[model samples]
Target: MDSTPGVTIDLTVADQDSKRFGSAPSPIKIGAVRMHGWQVHPISVASDQFDGADAYLVKFNYELGTTPDTPEMNWFELGVELREGVVVDAIPHHTQPTQTSVSYIVNDHLNLVPATNGVTPAAHLPATGETIHVFGVGSSGVRWQYWATSDTGVRWGSRVAWLVTLVDQETTHLDLTTIVRFDQRPTLDWNVLPAVTPADLRIELPTATNPRAEVTTQPANGTTVALLPSSPRVFISYTHDNNAHKQLVRDFANLLIKCGLDVRLDQFASPARKDWFLWANDNIDNADFVIIIASPKCLAVGEGKIDRNEHPGMHCELGIMRDRLQGNRRLWEQKLLPVVLPGESLSNIPVFLQPQAMDRYEIDELTEDALGDLLAAIHHGTEDNSRSPVVLMATSARRALADS
Candidate 1:
C-alpha cells in the first residue's frame, strides 16, 4: 500500500504503452508482499537496438489462497522507473492477460472461506518483453497498480506508447513514474488546455538509481482534482492604473465567462494592505495568464516614484508574467491577449511584445460591429492552437490601430 511515497501520478497514463531505446539498462525497483512480487523488466537489450524495437515489460505474479466456491483474487502492485532527459511518448496498445482467477480466498481472520470471487478479469495484461509506461511512485519504489476508489469507481488510463530519450542511460533509471492526468476527468465534459511549457506548467521530480528505490522527494502535492477545478482556467494578477477601466474590463471578462471561459480577476485590492506590490506579484506568479490593460496612465511612470521595493503597476505585472512565460512561447501568446480598451493607445508598447500585434478593440467606439469583431477574436483565442496565429493577428491589428 505504501509503494511509492510522496510521489504523484496522473492516473490517465496507467496501463498505457510506453516505448524507449538505449544500450544502457534503466534499472527498475519493485515492492510486494509474500508470494506476490511485481516487476518491470525491459525486453530489448542492445549494444544498440533497432528503432522501436526497444521495449519494457511489466509482470505481476502473486499467490492467492484457493477455496471452493469462494476463490481469492490477485492483488497486484507494480513499479516504473525514469531518468532525466527522458522523453515519454504515448503508444496506444491494449493487449493484457486477465489477472482475476480462481484461487483460495484469504479471510480477514485468515480462515478458509467458500465465497464467490469478487476479482474482475484482468485479461490482456502486458506480455513479456513489452514496453510499459509508468505513471508514478507509491511508498517504496514507483509502484504501478490498478487504483480505484471502489469497483464502482471508474478507472481512467491511456494505452498510448511513450518514448523516453535519456541523456545518460548509464546513470540508471530513476525509480519514479511520470505524473499525468486529463484536463477533464470524473466529468463527462471534455476540456482541452493548450500545450504550454511542460516545465513551467508543472513541477518535476528527481531520478534515482539505487536498488532499494529510496524515495528522494515528494512530488507536487497538488492533486489533479485540486489543481484543475471544474472551471476552464485559473487567473490572479495585477490591479493597475487601468483601475478606471476596471468596469469595462470586467464586462469583457464577464462576456468571456458567459461563453464558458474561466476568468480570474481581482477587482479591488484589500484596503488593509500596505505592501500591495508583493501580494500582487505573488498573484501573477500563479495565474495562467496576466491581462495588461494598456493605457497611457498604465504605462507612463509619474515623477517622484521611490523605494520601488516592488510595485503592482500594469507594466510590473507584465514583467513578472513574461518571466513565468519565458519558455512557453505558444501558450504565453495565447493566454496573454492584450485588450486595447477605449482611450488606450499602442504608441508606447514594449519591444518584445511588438512582434505580435495586440487585439485592438476600441471599446469606447463600441458599436455592435466592433463588439462582434472583438468577440470573434476572443473566441479564437479560446482554442489550443490559436495562440500563435491569434497573437500574430492581434499584434498586426494593434499595429494597424496604432498607425491609424
Candidate 2:
C-alpha cells in the first residue's frame, strides 16, 4: 500500500545523440513520490583535427503534482558529481532561467562563473571537503571531484542528481543520471549546452582497456599542449597604519588567494609563535615576488627618516631589501614591486625604488581587474626595457662608499 501523496514527474532525455550518450534509464521512483532519470554524456569537446565529443544537452521537464501555498515548496536543485580523474572544464550559468512557471534565482555564493574561452572561472576546482553549487533554486550539498593529468585523452565520469523539496517536509534526493564516461580533451571552443552542434558530438569506440591507462593521447597535427603553471608565491610588505588599513590589506590578500596565488602575509601567520625577524627574512628571501604597499609611513622608513625602534618588522624587512638591492641591483629591481592601494598616491612610494621612473602598480579597487598590472609584473617582468637611473646611481654610490 502506497501512502505517499500522488504526484507526477515525467523525466526524459532529449537532444541526446546515440553515439555520445548510452540508453537513458526510464524515470524511477526513489523515495516516497521522488522520481529520477539518468544518462551518460561526454564531458569533452571535439574538433576536426582531433576526435572527441562536445558538450551535450539534457532537457529536464519538471512539473509538481500540485501548487503549494508557500514559496519554499517550489525549491529544487540540479547537481553534478565527477568521478576520479574527471575535471570540470566549463559550466553554464543558471542565474537566469530559460523557462519556469515561478520566478527562479541562481545562488552565486560559490562565485561560479560561466565558461568563457581563455577566461578561468571561479569555483572550478572544489577542495577535498568543499562543495560547489553549479545550478540551483535553493541550497544543498553538491560534491564533485577534480584531478589534474598531462594526458590528452582521459576517461571522465560524472553523475547528475536532482533534489526536490515536497510540501509534506519529506525531501527527495536521487541520482538523475548514471556514470557517463567520455574522453576528456583540451579544447578552446567550449560551447554551452543547447548551442552545441550535433556534428561535434561523437564517442570514441573501444574505450581505454586498461584501468591504469585511463587516457590515450592522439597527436593532433603535432599540437603542443602546456600544463597550467604552479601558483606564484607572493609576499606582501605593508605598514600597520591603522585597523582599517590592516583590514584592507587582509582583504586584498584574500582576493589574491581566490585568484589562485600563494599569498604569504604576517596576519595569516600570527596564530603561531614566531621570531618576527626570521619570519620576515625567510619570506622575503623565498618569495618569487615581494609586494611593497606604498604609504606615507613606508616612505619614511625606506628613506631612513623613521626612528629605528618603531615598526621593527618593516625596518628589518626594508634593511634586508636594501642589502639585496645593493648586492644585485638588476635582479632586485625586477623582484621588488611597489604597489599603491586605493586612496593612496604614487608619491608615497619609496624614493630608492624610483616611483616616478620605474614601474609601480596602482590598484584603484580590490578586484582581479584592478590587480591586473601587479599580477602581470609578478608573472612576467615589467614591459619597460629601459634601466632605472635611480637604481644605477644608488648602486654606484654604495660601491664608492664601500671603497672609502
Best candidate, TM-score-wise? 2
Q: Write the per-residue lDDT of candidate 1 for residues 142-166, one digit (tens) a residue.
A: 3232322223221222221222222
Residue 285's lDDT within candidate 1 is 57
List per-prediction Cα lDDT, in the order shown. Answer: 0.33, 0.44
Which pairs of residues collide in candidate 2?
37-176, 38-176, 38-177
TM-scores for candidates 1 onward, in order: 0.31, 0.43
Model 1 residue 313 distance off true place after TM-score fit, in angstroms? 4.4
Encode model 2's per-residue lDDT on 193-280: one tens digit a residue: 1111111111121223411111112222333222123246789999887756866776787667545555777654422234778989
